[model samples]
Target chain A: MIEEFFLRALIAGVGVAAVAGPLGCFVVWRRMAYFGATLAHGALLGIALGLLIDVDPVFGIAASSVLIALIVTGLQRQGAIGGDTLLGILAHAGLALGLVALAFMSVRIDLMAYLFGDVLAVTWSDILWIYLGGTAVLATLALIWNTLLAITLNEELARAEGIDTARIQLVFMLILAVVIAIAMKIVGVLLIVSLLIIPAAAARPFARTPEQMAALAAAAGALSAAAGLFASLQWDTPAGPSIVAAATAIFALSFTFSGTLGKRAA
Target chain B: MALDKRSAGTGLLVEAKGLTVRFGASSALDGVDLTVSSGEIVSLIGPNGAGKTTLVRAVAGLVEASAGTLWRQPDLRIGYVPQRLSIDRVMPLTVRRLLSLAGRSSGAEIVSALAEVDAAALLKHAIHDLSGGEFQRVMLARALLRKPHLLLLDEPLQGVDLGGQLALYDLIGRLRRRHAMGVLLVSHDLHIVMAATDRVVCLNHHVCCSGAPESVRHHPEYTALFGAEAARRLAVYTHAHDHAHDLAGNPVAAADTNHADNEPEHLS
Candidate 1:
């Protein structure tokens, strides 16, 4: 039944994991974990802004994260400061701004819900949003997979091949922003990057190619979602953190088995 | 310098006139005129920071020329092997998958491409796991997969051993003969590429001198750019085996055989 909040939560979590798995591969490959964190941290500010302006929180998070991504991109081009330092500034500034703004809000916003997602409280509409957004992200990612891989391997070579690397980079950043916004509800803003990074990292040792890695990552993510949900139900733990823990466990297991598998294959 | 109308008539793969590339306030490449015709090998030689890499990048369309006109044959396919390719460890990419990036190719074609550079054994190897020489061979294989009209090789010999360098040069010569593709090679030492290249373009932010390997070795501009001592070394290397007696007691050009003897110390 739509009224069964746990069912709605499970569906939403799985949908988000399925998309995050492949997209997370790019994040890990490009070493954009900090970038992902920066965007996720900025989403909290978006939530506060959404509350102030009486707009949907998802829309607010997407707007603020995209804005931060663009700002990061522009500052990187200026070459005034190094990338990690720039991300650190934006990441902390965003989190600090969000906390301060929340303090000033007249409405008693349930800050805990946004900080660590309340997946068990999800509604049927949340499931619809997850599936629709997830599909769009996955399809676009599929279309640009080769180009993204090419760019990631060597920007100069990709440019020489006449691939529009700049356009692809813009598209990638926007997709990351959207994913972080949608994923905020599943793992919360604090742990959103774990959803994007862990499963992909876990999938690496077993995969011989990029496509294999992406597919395996998606499977790992889905498995984590299902297992984390069940674990949360059994242990009365927070769903988002439980999911991340399950993904971590899988990652650790991968290290143990992958070596033997690699030896056998060799 | 006047453009060679003869090469233009025959078919030029790439032509750049006054190609200048500026990075921020400084000029990386300045007022360079160059051309690569079908089936020709053009070696670009320059000292470090002399814009040799920048020139190759400009021709490959990786960098835009700040003030120049560059032309390529319409629909020309270019296979470029960069001086260095650093694959992230996290990215799971095998040699076969890398070759597929140019477009889809049959498994046989992939094998043949790898075999062309004597790297067939690396078909399933992860790119990150490859040693420097192995990585270069795989990169060459990736470029060969395109069956390109032109090949831009930027310091393809950087990390290769002496024997591997000779093999790569032989492979390049074979590719030129077999595919008739124009090749723009960048190297630090002109002596090594002298035998294989049809013309050597010496660069120091601009064209110092360019002509047949022998002439460029003697060109005053080249002498000035590289100094008289280096020029003498290059000339000796070029003329060292110009006349040789084969088993039949007939004079033969042993340039190819003598290539190993003149292996530049820098390369070693």
Candidate 2:
């Protein structure tokens, strides 16, 4: 099974896509694509710290991303700096720090693998991490689905209905951190937000409801993973970028079909 | 009206005492007291920055009072229709989905709730696709789905045309009659709702005047808060309706005729 590297990559990539699809809907709804990018960029710092402390890189990524999410949440409330500017500072700072740390490391490191993903290099243990982490994120999202949707619609309305909006927001941020941590190998830090956003955006025009949109996003993402994997094998293209390219193509196709449906509905 | 007052014993849904809300340094709402009773329509009227929204939010428990005591019925269920909820065009949410936000509602329940607000045909429509009047109906439908004891409507007539506004007011009046739900509405258009509202509270950071619509229209506090011309116009509108009655459930024929005679002069 270890010999079938491409098969392993496909499985890992599909699993990540499934989780990223629904989570991505919130990203699109809340306009948190840049926030997703910041968390993904911080994963590199986690990897560096993991190496320095002799811990698993996955754990390192999860911890660092969560820390960064908390910091962003805290800073956003202070209102001293705008949200996008804050995210830009954190994104670049985390990426630069991670790169510097990697440079100073005594052991040889393949920086390209972390930056653009090394799906072909994934081991069976990596599959376990991806599925386990992905399942946890999915389960939490399901448990809070209604509450999250309510909050997304209007925070004040949700609060008036007795929902703990602030706590739900915090939990949502944590789930995003976990997803970024586990999805690193499938799409890498640079392309992680793309995977989280593109499929959801593509599925939007065709969907009539939130649940339908989520299901369609997952299907679109999985299809992209399978198609992209095949394309990479045929063209020798990078797997992560190829997956994103396939997603973009699907999005373009949706526009053609969705316009008529939108017209009919109108 | 007497029947409602008797049935809703003590007639209290929400009571706020000396409610004050401060944002950093400035006070959005200061030392305001409000009472909403079941089977009653209480309209909060104010100009921009008058803390009408703050008062509504505070009563809905969306915003905590910096210094005040707020009381509610032990089993109070509030249905809130916000003044403006900007639904992002990107998200795909149908009217049915929005109604199911609190929890899973049966298809039949969804249909009936939509019908309650005269939006049964819009159940399948995407939220972003609906026109402003249609959207307000959907919002009202969603609020009704909660089977609330109290309905908090913030400028529910906004974006609705004159005809639609009249129909909505009729529907709201029907809702009060059917469910006996307490309604606390924030309205900018005093002319439209003056006849429907049982009480009118004029606010400008504090309660300028609050009483029966007829009295509030004449209160110096209300006239001072809103100009004398505006008060005269409100009084004219209030008396223009043949169906209008005083708070004591009596038809004020003399008052109506007096105002009807004065209406042209005020308009001129």
Candidate 3:
């Protein structure tokens, strides 16, 4: 029974790593790390909505993430408030609202499952959603790869070259929304940003171009997920935070070595 | 904003009518009007605060024209090479990769564009490691790949030294001849602009003056902006900025302007 649960957790971890790798590249490139955290925090409200409405948690998370992304993008375009201030408001508001909604629910809720994730309790159906959602996000990212990269380099230059930046930006935000929704299930709402940022940051020292960085980040993410699974099995640590901790360790090591090698190369 | 007949029949490719741009309360460009015709290399010359960058930004569509209309070709694609193409220096990118971001271009086309700028050899090198001059050449190469009808260059000759500037001028001249693109180049190098551009348009919160490089050189307003010596130097070169030929032997550049002599010292 224990081995079966472990096997399921391993599969889910692998799926999460694959999705996090390329998505993290944009997070690092656009300097959207804080924004990722803000959205992930908003995912908790998504969880609350799922419970309140009796819908799938993933769908609720995606809807909430999309809402947050649109609001942030719109507010930024209007230049009404500073980006960080707005993000802080939305981040805390989502968390607070979700907690309030959880209180009003009649049934006993597994708070730890949503906060820290339950890889050991993973079902085959959950794995299916992970793969299906992961494929959709990755495929969309592949289709608009060049266009997204162009906008990342310089929006004005991209527009001058006839690439519609507004549409591309909307697509990117949507993809990010989906990634956040799926990632929430694996890493839990609070720690979701780790899966998106840590792997990419770890791969930073090794990559030369945006494409290379993304590939390397995904590879690093998978390795960390596997390592974190082992650590969880040995000590019975929570799977979600364990994976994040493993990624953090890898990042520290990479940082030390990359700094030394980077200095020498220069 | 009225344009004379000579300006109207000059085959104008781009017309900026009463272009006004403001950043907060300060007016960067105030009711500025200018026109660029086909087969001419025009220079937008002005002092540091003369709205040259603002006008260029408005033309490139980087900034809105606040309260004016820009009339150009319906498909008026522009190639922009900014004052400094500063990348994160840490990011690894090749010249080919940089060009690829601008638009899709065949390997042969890329080589041809690079050859135009004499930067064919630096194609494989990391762009961040390139020198300022080589970087500018690469930028020019990338811009040429778009086959732009209007090429807007912002202070192309700023940081580059004498040797680099001369090579860039040669490349610019070749691009102009081959593409016949309307080039609106901005430069603070008064001495170089006097020699290289066909016409100089003096801009300072407005179109102070615009005429042939030689005529603009003799205009009192032009001399007032940059001493008599600098104005004469502008008239000498034939868009090449190389050595002065027969028509370039004028020594008026050596004659110090009375107004230029008494101005307060301003270091760049």
Candidate 4:
């Protein structure tokens, strides 16, 4: 009953959302929303450079995000400057440099498509990349899940218990970078962090444990993807923003159930 | 390695000889030699800028030593209760979930660990909602879940009421006896600390004095560093030891060489 292009878009969007849900919880837990924003901004530069070099944009995005992650980690270790200020600076610079590079590129590219995402234009190859790359990301995340949770809870505590915290942190950043590389096609640069965090926040009101929160976040994100896709079709709206809007709506709606988890939070 | 007083079997869990840790140019811990053997409670006491926390971290292998030899028993399992471990509100966590972080712990094991800390009912309670004393009990439960050979507790009594501190210290004493574990306690409170400590190492960037709890109180370096008033207040929990106070005189002389400029600054 559905056209193939619409079906492809649904599959791709839902796939990205499922992966984003678990990783997004870490983003929220670690209070790294600005860090996520910084990585997405750096991802834009990756896309521009990829087109310039005539290589796969996924590779460029991964490289750029990972490089930004390393720089942030290094700066945190030095810890001489304010962390949020440094992140704000890097985020703006990455965005400005990316825009300048995109303006100078010779190839004809739709700036709006990369800025807000063009989910309807995704091809079979893009869907393939989403599933394959996302599988690798999720598996790696599972491998480091407990240690990552430990570090997120307390880095010093993890190190005290014989965990190699620095290596675990670098590995977590790499996973975040890979997620950015794949999910960039679905939510685009500007609203990518919303896709990563909103669903996790929505699930928090119901979850009583970390694993439950992660599983609930994935389900919430998937439901949001499906709902946002249909809403876009009905209203003839931009697909990416529609998905983010749907997620925000769910996040807002979840407050009604706040007492479920909130009553015990004090 | 030569500082290792005994093998792992005999429970010389961690030993440091002339260990020095530097942050840039300033020395946090200088020429520190400390050791903890089985069934021993060694309390590290110092002022605000003292490297007490740093020494605990170093023994737990968190910080790299710049100089001197630091050795731990091979395959040493450590249970470390950090000074500050406030679980963020954003995290949805129960006491049960917190203990499970120690890996492979079961429901029965979790319950028992909580029972060991006198907080058996907190197993299902949300960690964020726990009172300061309750949160500490839960953290101790988590650490106990590791079944560690060495327990490193950094300021375990912070934010706790004095009555609650005595209770907590009692719980720690029972756990140590039952598990035969070595305890490395870092604390700033003198009144309650001397009551619980078997040995006290007064530290201020270096080892000022170390001996039986009562003996170290009268040492010149200890009195000079913490102020004589602190030493007098610490005498509140006096207990007779086999060795007399003057037995610590030799280490006091050695320790004074590094901080000769620091005279006894009596409390005003």
Task: State TM-scores per candidate.
Answer: 0.85, 0.87, 0.85, 0.87
Better of 3 and 4 by DockQ: 4
Q: Return whichever of 3 and 4 wins on lDDT.
A: 4
Q: Where in model 2 is the C-alpha error above 4 Å?
A: A1-3, A260-266, B1-9, B190-192, B215-268
| lDDT string, candidate 1, B101-212, tens digits | 8666788888888887888999888877787778888887788777788899999878777556656677788878777789999965755453567888867677755767
Better of 2 and 4 by DockQ: 4
- Candidate closer to the true structure by TM-score (higher is better), 1 or 4: 4
Q: What is the C-alpha interface RMSD of model 3? A: 2.4
For model 4, residues B150-184, the per-residue Cα lDDT tens digits are 89999988878755665677788788777778999
For model 2, the local distance difference test gives: 0.81
Report the C-alpha displacement of residue B19, candidate 1, in angstroms.
2.4
lDDT of 3 by residue, B40-66 (tens): 788887556768987887777778888
* Model 2: per-residue Cα lDDT over B72-119, one tens digit each: 888788889887887887888888888878555677888888888888
The residue-by-residue lDDT of candidate 2 on A174-245, one tens digit each, is 899888888888889999998899999999987888888899999999988888988999999999899999
Clashing pairs in 2: none
Stretches off by above 4 angstroms in model 1 are A1-3, A260-266, B1-9, B104-108, B214-268
Tens digit per residue, CA lDDT, model 3, A1-266: 45887888888888888788888888877889889888888888988899799998777887888899889988988898999999999999998998888889999998877877777788898888888988999999998988988788777677767788989878888888788777766778788888888888888788767788889889889888889999988998888899999999999998898893556433
Candidate 4 structure quality by residue, lDDT tens digits, A82-158: 89988998888988899999999987799888888888989999999899988998999999998889889998988
Clashing pairs in 1: none
Runs in model 3 lying further than 4 Å from the true structure: A78-80, A260-266, B1-11, B22-26, B189-194, B214-268
